[model samples]
Target: MSGSEQAPVVGVSTYRQRAVTGVWDVEACLTPAPYVEGVTRAGGIAVLLPPQPADAAVAAAVLDRLDGLVLVGGSDVDPALYGAGPHDATDPPQRQRDTWEALLVHEAIARGVPFLGICRGAQVLGVALGGTLHQHVPEVIGHHGHRAGNAVFTPTVVTTVPGTRVADILGDGVTAPCYHHQAIDRVADGLVVGARDDDGLVEAVELPDHPFGVAVQWHPEEDLDDLRLFAALVDASARRRTGAYA
Candidate 1:
């Protein structure tokens, strides 16, 4: 099979990580290896997109080449973007990454590219779509079950709405690894809630009219065993490349 017959290209955004590489301390663009592995396992070519200057042209250029986009999990979004003040528990914001990823999200949506947002990625999608966030889940939910601590993933049970894309993919009742402290507050107009937790917190969303746009508040990449979500994204990317949706 040729390149066109092979898996579609999926761009995964990365966060800035400070590291010591070969005795040189430097800031690096990085994401968990599983983000790449998950996409590959789902038969999609994974491309890591590091934080770039807040340039719409650059973002559009990147989106032009990608069949899909995966907004990987990372730091909290800057509250100012949604006209809110920061919460005490919210982590210090990564403004540069926020700007870059926000542009990518908007560009991908405008181009009708299939995209998946995980954790912070999901929050970014909501904000880009003219939505707001809860800022801190615990404050409203009255618990920290969503995020136990730093570097820890909690097992979460989410229920998908009937006849929705999430329910079609993962069924109604599904359990996945979750590590988030913020969630969608005021959902955007064109989007609809696709899944929720037992606490009634929004867990997933989908843009029904779009070719494929899903954002989940969990880390499916960490599941490793379940590639259904990634596979769905890859399939949608293939369809987009083939002009099946146009």
Candidate 2:
């Protein structure tokens, strides 16, 4: 492809936490390897967007430089943002990350940038748009299958809603690699459920009005063999870059 048609620049959100690298422990901004690999494998340039002090203006300025945005799974969002108290199982508040990500979600929607949220990323999208979370999936679903803990990922069967972008990409059903304990509850107003599990728990959501806006409770990046979701996001971004998406 020519420079004008080069792969789109896709920004993936990362975690800000302490790490021990080469006997040196320090705070760093990072995400799992799969996230960056997924984007590159799907024909997009990957850029990591770490937590930083940000406002709407900053968010817009950041979005102004990218063709697509991706919110990856990480620590739990503070329940306070959605007007609730913490659930014992919930991870302690990552306030800075929450604030920065929320801004990106809001601004990305307004700008109609292609977006894909994974695991906690899905929850972030919901809360950023006035929705809430179940806090603990096992408590609500009566099953511990959604998350098996100990850095283990449970295999989940997901059924996509017909006529939705997720369905168009993933077909009727897919077994996803999932490790989330908190699920979206009372989905955001403008966002529609795009897929669900047999238990009726929401597995995916999409903004119909946007060129491309989709989020899944499962960790698509974990399944490197299946890059369909990532490819779809990159495809939409490419279309947007070439003025082929309306």
Which candidate should be chosen as best, given lDDT against the real structure?
A: 2
Question: What are the per-residue Cα lDDT tens digits for candidate 1 across 73-112?
Answer: 9889999999989989777888889999999999998999
- Local accuracy by lDDT, each model: 0.90, 0.93
State how far residue 107 of model 2 sits from its true place (Å): 0.8
Each candidate structure's TM-score, on Cα atoms with residue i matched to residue i, is 0.96, 0.97
Clashing pairs in 2: none
lDDT of 2 at 147: 88
For model 1, the stretches where C-alpha displacement exceeds 4 angstroms are 1-5
* Model 2 lDDT at residue 87: 97
